[model samples]
Target: MQQRRDKDWDLSIGPDTVRLFILKAKAISAGVNEDYEDGAEHEVEFDGDARDNHHHDGLAEEETEDLTARELRELIGDLNVDEAAELVALAWVGRGDYDASEWQDAVAEARQRGNRRTAKYLLGMPMLGDWLEEGLEVLGA
Candidate 1:
């Protein structure tokens, strides 16, 4: 991804930070819908009757998802009011609720909505990562 030039846009939060959030969001998305045994080969044994044995190794995956989610939540929670609102506005643009030309209006609306539940609201979106990435692209970040 190309770095956003300071002269080109005035962003409350850094693009790099947004990229990190995208990565974590994608990880959480994958972890939530993933099946542990999708492509693994299992050995079957015949002792009187055929038996299929495969261990469901979802515990580790669950833990990783939990950690990633926590990190994402923390990251969003730590942002300042302006930064958090910017994130919401970016998402709105990415989701097609607003066009890139309406960025200021979207940001104003996001700020009006407040950042009290920003993390929770953002985390609830299953397509958070994709939307954020699309938003960044739209903004030429």
Candidate 2:
């Protein structure tokens, strides 16, 4: 199979926002090199139970404020891999400030063009999930 682009490994994001599922597969799955290891798979995360958790460390702040409750929900309604990845990328674009109108417009346009996927596919390699799953809250479906 072809390897994901360098952007997928380390996006130097600028005016354009692009992400491919192939990269997610690479980052979430096995790594390159002879001593490659499935770190995420075997890494023991013993933070604590949800009740006692005060982990704000993993979450990024909002970026696109324009993504209103309805808009964001609509975007994530039937998300696919691409959409999920884009959401993750967008979160970065928003710089953890996910409350911008431009971001909302971009997402909406991408959706119109048939982008958006389940968040499961865009977990690591930059696109944070704690950030993505929260969008589901907007949908409340």
lDDT computed for candidate 1: 0.84
Q: How good is model 2 by TM-score?
A: 0.24
> Residue by residue across 1-141, what tens digits does model 1's lDDT show?
323323445899999999999999999888765643465333445566565454556577678789999999999999999999999988887888887778889899999989999999999998999989988888888
User: CA lDDT, every prediction?
Assistant: 0.84, 0.36
Candidate 1: residue pairs that collide: none
Give per-residue lDDT, candidate 1, residue 70.
97
The residue ranges of model 2 lying beyond 4 angstroms of the native Cα positions read 1-98, 116-121, 124-127, 133-141
Error of 1 at 50 (Å): 9.1
**Steric collisions counted per model:** 0, 22
Say which candidate scores most in lDDT: 1
- Regions more than 4 Å wrong, model 1: 1-8, 36-52
- Per-candidate TM vs. native? 0.82, 0.24
